[model samples]
Target: MDHVNISVANNEEKGANVDFDYSQRAQWLRAAVLGANDGLVSVASLMMGVGAVKQDVKAMFLIGFAGLVAGACSMAIGEFVSVYSQLDIEVAQMKRDHITNHDQELAEKENLPSPFQAALASALAFSLGAIVPLLAAMFIDSYKVRLAVILAAVSIALVVFGAVGAVLGGSSRVKSCVRVLVGGWLAMAITFGLTKLIGSSGLQM
Candidate 1:
């Protein structure tokens, strides 16, 4: 009877640990998907806006590169600050709870969010997403072809990202893909239309 009880308790503990690990994985995946989507949409829109006003390949490359660098840095800094704040709150809570055992406190701190890790992950995800449009337009010389390729590449990327996110999150893949695709199209279209309209008004630079 004692052996059976011990085995059951150990099995329960193992199951709980697995659940905790899975939850952590889900949270990480969610963050990565969101960061990548933001980077893809923002950089692609910026490129489309620039392409609308100026068909120069140099101009498009410059704008896309600038957007990637700026977006990555912004994401890294924002994530670092946000995660650091959360870490502070968690540490404070632990203190309030009067965790007396050093080993216990250390274990809790180990599980706390690492601001550096979060920042790096955010930056890398943004850069990865921002590279799609840049690479799509890189070899294409014709202005119209470049724009079309960029749109195509970005649309494909958006769909892929959405599908991956949906799979990991256990959501409806069709809905997720459609939502991401539509949102990306709207963003690029709006930026292009607005920039073209403004440029038509004889705005310089």
Candidate 2:
């Protein structure tokens, strides 16, 4: 009887461990993906724009650094605020559900992420993504070569991020990757084109 009880206890523990739903952590996944995507595209676009106007390695590097810092900070603060607000709303909803509907199960099923966790994830992901382009173009001296390398690096990173996000979210991986790739390309192309156009017209940055 003791052995039987021990076996049952072990099974219960195992079941409890397995009961966690990964989908419940989707909020953090989304925040991380968004931060990474924003970091990649925005820094890549900024690098391309600066490259279009001035290919000075130092200038491009400075601008890229500034963008990474600013973007990461922005992502962290924005994600914290947004996630906190969502959590607040969820909590309020739970209260309403419990008070009005008396649905204890519904109120008790809160699997939301912490605002700090979401914010930290976003900031770290953004920093990681932003570093890719910076490292890719770090050693290249030629402006065209640097730009090409940055584009290639950014494209690969975006595709990977999109695919991972899709897989985690149970969406179509290929479609997500293609969509992110195209969006990234559009951003860079537009930024580069505008910079070149404006620079040529005597508004060089």
Clashes of each: 0, 0
| Whole-model lDDT values for every prediction | 0.91, 0.87
Query: Residue 151 CA error for candidate 2 (Å)?
Result: 1.0
| Per-residue C-alpha lDDT of model 1 across residues 1-205, encoded as one tens digit per residue | 9999999999999999877866777646755887899889989999999999999988998999999999999998998999899999999999899999999988998889888888888888889899999999878889999999999999999999999988877689999999999999999999999999999999999
**Candidate 1 residue runs with Cα over 4 Å from true position:** 1-18
The TM-score of predicted model 2 comes to: 0.82
